[model samples]
Target: MEMSREKVAVVTGANKGLGYEIVKALCRKTTASYLTARNEEKGRRRSRTARTRPQAEIPSAGHPPKVYQTDQTLIVNFFSLVDFCETISPLMRNGGCIVNVSSSSGHLSRIPSQRLRERLKDENLSLDELKVLMQGYLLAVKHSRDVEDGWGESPYVVSKVGVNAYTFILHRRLAPRDIRVNCVHPGYIRTDMTKGEGNVLPEQGADVVVQVALSDSRGQYVWHNGTPVPWCGDDPRIWIDGKV
Candidate 1:
């Protein structure tokens, strides 16, 4: 696999908050950057604020401009990731990396069912199987049985969990191509997603994500301060009081 002289990056949900910061951080190093957001206007405005030359400002199609809705969360957080990987991975030069922004809430301990946790932890889990799991979560939500079915009440949590799990599978598949993939819990930062209630600032969190994106680590779930957290193990309490 040959590496490219010019680096490129793409960030999703980058109109504001952590995503915006991530784009800013990447712009400092990458020769080209592309960002996508649910709100086209805000995305363009924020891109100007970042003062980075974005190659494209893609708008998420069919994604309602809402937060935390189960179906929408899955679409924005998980399925959109799938779409990006399939579309961009082939274009990425060797030695490039993909960072999936996840949250500590994605920890397997957040799931009530041990069986479901074990299934997600399977090293042999395929992309098709992962999609089935996501669909099952949606079905459970439709029936108002998510909690009883072992998934937690937060669609955000389930979506991030899916992101973490998918990171592992993607790393395995992309290894031969010399393209690294990792998921990051960018610390509980003061963002709209957190209702502005977090100890770390978005720029601080973005630094960590940028560090991981340029590192050689593959398929690991990392904390905002650059520590690796077990995606399948119990919660490491990294988010308590926004402590790194």
Candidate 2:
């Protein structure tokens, strides 16, 4: 992509939280950003809301708004990401970049049962198969207040695992065309996802993602920052004796 020409980026779940911060960083450092949220009205409202607040009325005597708190937003979030990717596929210059903002929860070994783990290990899983797997997780979430209790207590964990799996899937399809497809664990950043518990900041996480998007064309999985954070042992090539 030309440095002078405007570049385009699509960030999912960007109304607030890390996603919003990523958009802010990208707008500051990169090119135009397509800020995506599950609810377009809500996203626009947030923009309006941010502007409407008086200087004196703001929290901490006028600092900034924070992450949105909601329990059942992921269903819409997944579909929003899909929509963004599909809509932008044709407009992408230099084959574009895709950053699936996953979590360390995706790498958890203690979440899934042995049978489910074995099932995920199979490389031949079809899109239909993956859908069924994901559906099972949604169902679990719907039926129980606690998703972990319902479906091994790893909905977020399993969703991210699926994300990592799909990253390689997209990479295989795009690498030949020189379209970069990669995944990153945002290092436990303090966002709604981490419930403000993580030590890392949103700006720090956004930097890592921006680095990968801007890196030279290399067909590899990476977590870009000061250095590449390797896949957490789930990758068979990197895994040795049951560790990454």
Top lDDT model: 1
Residue-by-residue lDDT tens digits, candidate 1, 12-97: 88887778788888888854888778778877888777864333333435544323379888998899888788788888787789
lDDT of 2: 0.58
Candidate 2 TM-score, C-alpha based: 0.67
What are the models' TM-scores?
A: 0.85, 0.67
Once fitted onto the true fold, the runs of candidate 1 whose alpha carbons sit more than 4 angstroms away are 1-4, 51-68, 238-244
- The lDDT of each candidate is 0.82, 0.58
Clashes, model 1: 0
- Top TM-score: which candidate number? 1
RMSD of 2: 7.4
